[model samples]
Target: MESFASLFAGLGLFFIGIRYIGSHLKRMTGRRFRRAVAAATRRSGTSAIVGVVAGALTQSSNAVTFIAVGLVTAGLTEVRRAAPLVAWSNVGTAGLVLLAAMDIRLLVLFLLGLVGFAYYFDVERSARWRHVVGALLGIGLLFLGLQYIKAAAGPLRELEWMSAFLTFAGTADWLGLVIGLLGALILQSSATLTIMAVTLTGLGLLSLEQTLVLVLGSGVGSGLSVAVMAGGLSGSARQLAYFQVAVKLLGSLGVLLLFWLERDGGVPLLLAAVQALAEGTALQMALLFLVIQLAGALLSHPLQRPLLRLCASLAPPAPAEALARPRFLYDQALEDSAIALELVEREQQALLTRLPALIPADGQVAPPPAERQAVLEASQEVVAEVERFLSEVVQRSEGDEALERAMNFKSRNALLQALCETLDELMTALDTSNGSAGPPPLSVNLTEAAHALLDSLMEAGGEGEAVDPQLLRALTADRSALMERLRRDLLRNGADLDADQRNGLLAATALFERLVWLIHRYAVLLPDSLAEGISQKAPERAST
Candidate 1:
C-alpha cells in the first residue's frame, strides 16, 4: 500500500511537471514559434522538422498540434501542409520518453539546484528569466518523480501479485495492449505510460515484444484522448485531431504486421536493428518507440491528401458553426499583448465586413429573418469574445506601451459592438420597408447612404485609404438635410400615410441616420496601424 501511494503521488507530480513545462514554453516562445512554423510550411519536409523541434521544446505533442491547427484556421498555413507537422510532433514526443529512460538523475539534480539558487537570489532581473526558471523547476520535478516511481516499482518485483500480472501481460499481447491503452488514457500522456513500461522492462517483468505492443497501444490511446477533446470542435480543428488518430492507428497496424512476420520465422528486422544500436532492455524499447513514429511519418507522407479528405468526410464542418466561431482570436496570441491586440483589431474588421451583407440589394426582397438572425448572432458572439479576450489581455499586460495599446483596443471593441447593434436595427427597418406598396423616398436615400458608407469602409480597410474628411462632412450634411426634409413632408402630407406607415417610416429614418453616423464615426476612429494590416484587394460593397 505504501509503495502504491508513493507511485501514484510521483505520477501526479510528473504530470504536473509536464503540464507546467509545456505551458511555460508556449508562453515564452508562442508568437515567434508560430510565425516561424507558419513560414516553414511552404514545404512539408521543413514543417516536419519544425514540428519535431517545437514538440521537443514544449514536451507535449498536443501543444504542437494545437499550434498547427490554430495556424491553419487563421489562414496563416494551409491544411495540407499541417499533416507533416502533426506527424513529426508524434516523433518529437518520443524524445521526452527517451530522455526520461536515461539515468541522468545526478546532472538533473545539480542543474535544478543551480537554477533554484539563482531564482532565490533574483539574480536575473528580466521577466523572461521567470519562465526559464519555471521550466527548469518543472524539469527537475519530472526527473525527481521518475526516481520515486522507480523506487516504488523496485519493491513490486518481490511481490507475488505483481509477478503474476506481468506474467499474464507478457504471454497475452492483447492484454498488454489493453493495459497500455487504459494507462495512457488515465494519465492523459503516452510518454508517461511509456516511461512506466520502460521501468517495468528494467525490472525484468516484461519482454521486449510485450513492451512494443504496449507502446503501440499508448500511441493509439494518445490519439483517442485528443479525439475526445476535439469532439465538440468543428472544421480544421476537429480534422487535425482525426488526422493524429489516423497516423497512430496506421502505425499501430504496421507494428502488428511486423510482429506477425517475425513470429512466422521471418527476419526479426526491428529486433536486429535495436540490438545493433542499443544495449539495455529499456533503451531498446525506447529505440523501438522512435522507430515506430519515424516509420509512421515516412509512410504517411504520400497519403496526406487522402488522409485529409478522409478526416473531412468523417467530420464535415457545419457552415453555421464556422460562422459563429471567433476566427482571428487565438489563444496562442494571448501570451503577447501586441499580437493579441492586432488579432482583436483584425476580428473587429472581420465583424465590420459582415455588415454589408445585410444591406438590401436593389430590386431584391429583404433577406429572410433566419439569415439576418444568423448574421446578427454570429457578429454579436464574435464581438463579445473579442471583448472578453481584450479584458484578459489588459489584466495580464504590463508596461505603459502594452496598457495603452490595450486601452485603445478596448475602445475599438466598444465601437464595433455598437456598430453591430446599429446594423441589426437597420436590417429590421429594411425588412419593414418591404411591406410598403412602393419604396419610400427616404428608403432610396438611406440605401444610397449605406452603399456610400460601405464603399468608403472597404477602401479604408483594404488600401489603408482613409475616408476623406471632406467626403464625410458632405455625406453627414446631406443625411441631416434629407432627414429634415422628410419630417416637413410628413407634416405637410399627414393624411397620405396611416398611423402604422408613419411610425414605420419614422423608425426607418431614425435607424438609417444613426447607422450612417455610426459608420462615419467608426471611419474617423479607425487607427492607422490597424488599417495597414488589411488585405490588398478591396471587398465588394453591398448594393442597395
Candidate 2:
C-alpha cells in the first residue's frame, strides 16, 4: 500500500510539473516564438530548426503543432512551410525523454534549492521573471517526482499483483504495445509513459523487449490523442493535426516492424544500434524512444505532399479559414512601396465588401448564428493582417506621395475596423432585442436603415468606382437628432417592450449612429481620382 501510494503521488507530481513547464514556457517565449515561426521563409531547413526549438521549449509536440496551425491561419506562413516545423517538433520532444533517462537527483536538488530562494524573494511576482521561476520550479518537481517513483519501483516489484501484471504485460509483444497505447491515451503524454517504462525496466520489473514495444505503442497513442483532441478543428488547422498523427503512427509502427525482424530473423537493426550506443536497459529504451521519433520524421518528410493531399481530402479547409486569409498582400510586393500600398488598398476593399453580410438580409430567414459569428471573426482576422501589412508599407514609404497614400490607407483601415466592430455590436443588440414577442418595431427599422447605408458604402468604396464625396457625405449624414427623438418616443409610446427589449433598442440605435459616422469618415478619406478615367466632381475637402 505504501509503495502504491508513493507511485501515485509521484505520478501526480510529474503530471503537474509537466503542465507547469509547458504552459509557462509558452507564456515566457510566446511572442518570440511566434516571431520566429513567422520569420520562416521558403527554406525548409529554417522551418525544421524552428520546429525543433518549439518542441524543445514547449516539451510537447501538440503545442508545436497548434502554434504552427495558428501561424498558418494568421497568414504568417504557408502550410507547406509549417509542415516541416510540425514534423521536426516531434524530434525536439525527445530532449526531455533523454534527460529523464540519466541521473538527475543532484540537478533536481539544485533546482529546488534555487526555486526555494527565488520564491522566498517573491521572484514569482515579477512579471518578467515569473514564467522563468515557475518553469524552473516545474523542472524541480518533475525530477523530484521521478525520484519518488524510482524509490517506489523496487518495493512495487515485490507485490504479488504487480508481479502478475508485469508477467501478463510481458507475455506477448503485442500486449505490451497495447498496454503502452492505453497508458498514453489516458495520460496524453507519450514521453511520460516512455519514462515510466524506462523506470520499470531499470528496476528489472520489465525486460528491454517489453519496454520497447510499450514505447512504440505510446508513440502511436500520442498521435491518436492529438487526433481526438483536435477533432473540433477543420481546414488547414485540421490538416496539420492529421499530419502529426501520420508521422507518429508511421514512425512507431515502422520501428515496431524493424524490432520484430531483428528479434525473429536475426537481422541487426534499431535494437542493435541502441545497444551499441548505451549499455543500460533504461538508456537503451530512451535511445529507442528518440529513434522512433526520428523514424517518424524521416519517413514522413518525403511523403508530405501525398500525406497532405490525404489530409485535405479527409478535412477540407473550412469556409471561415478561406475567408480569414488575405486575398492580396504578398511579401514581394513590399519591395516596391507603390505595389505594397496598392495591395493594401485592395485587401481593405475586400474587407469592406464583407461588412454588409454581418447584418442578416431582411424578409429572408436570418443566417445561422454560428455562420454569422464565423464571418465576423474572419473579418476581424483580415483586419489584423491589413494593419500589419500597412505597417510594413509605412516603413518602406520614401516620399510624400507614397507616405501620404500609406497614411491614407492606414486611416481608412482604422475606420473599416471600427465599422466591423460597430456592426458586430449592432447585430448583438438586435439579437438580444428579439425576445418572446420578437424584436421591437424600432429595432427592426434601425437594422434595415443600417443595412441600406452599408449597401451604398460598399458601392461607393468598391474597387474602380469613383466616389462622389458630397453624395457619400449626404448618404452617411449624421442622424443623431433622428435617433434621439426615436429613443424618446420609444420610452413614451413603447409600452409593450420589456426592459430587455427597450435596452436593446437603445443600444441598437446608438451603434447604428456610430456605424454611420464611421462610414462617413471612411468615405472622406477616399482619393479624389479613384479610377483611371473618372475625375473628382466635388471640391476637395479636408479629411475629418
> Which candidate has the highest TM-score of all?
2
Off by over 4 Å in 1: 123-125, 264-266, 317-353, 359-418, 421-517, 523-544
306-362: candidate 2 lDDT, tens digit per residue: 999999999988888988989997777888999898788788878877777667558
- In model 1, how large is the Cα lDDT of residue 64? 78
How does candidate 2 score on lDDT?
0.84
Error of 2 at 432 (Å): 8.2
Candidate 1 — what's its lDDT? 0.75
Structural similarity to truth (TM-score) of each candidate: 0.71, 0.85
Clashes of 1: 0
Query: Tens digits of per-residue lDDT for model 1 on 1-544?
Result: 9999989988877777777777677777666678789878879889999988887887667777788877765556667788798888878878877887788989888978987897779954568687887777788888787777887878878889978887877778888788777877776667778877887786676788888989888878877887887777778778888998888777777877887677667776787778789888888999888887777777778887899999999878656545666877766798998899888877776766776666755655556778877777767767776877788799889889998878877776776777778777776665565445776666666766676676566555423355454455345543778777886786677566666666666777777777777666666655554433333323433231
Which ten contiguous residues of candidate 2 have the minimum total lDDT?
535-544
- Looking at model 2, the pairs that clash are 235-317
Off by over 4 Å in 2: 1-5, 120-129, 331-341, 357-371, 389-414, 424-448, 488-508, 524-544
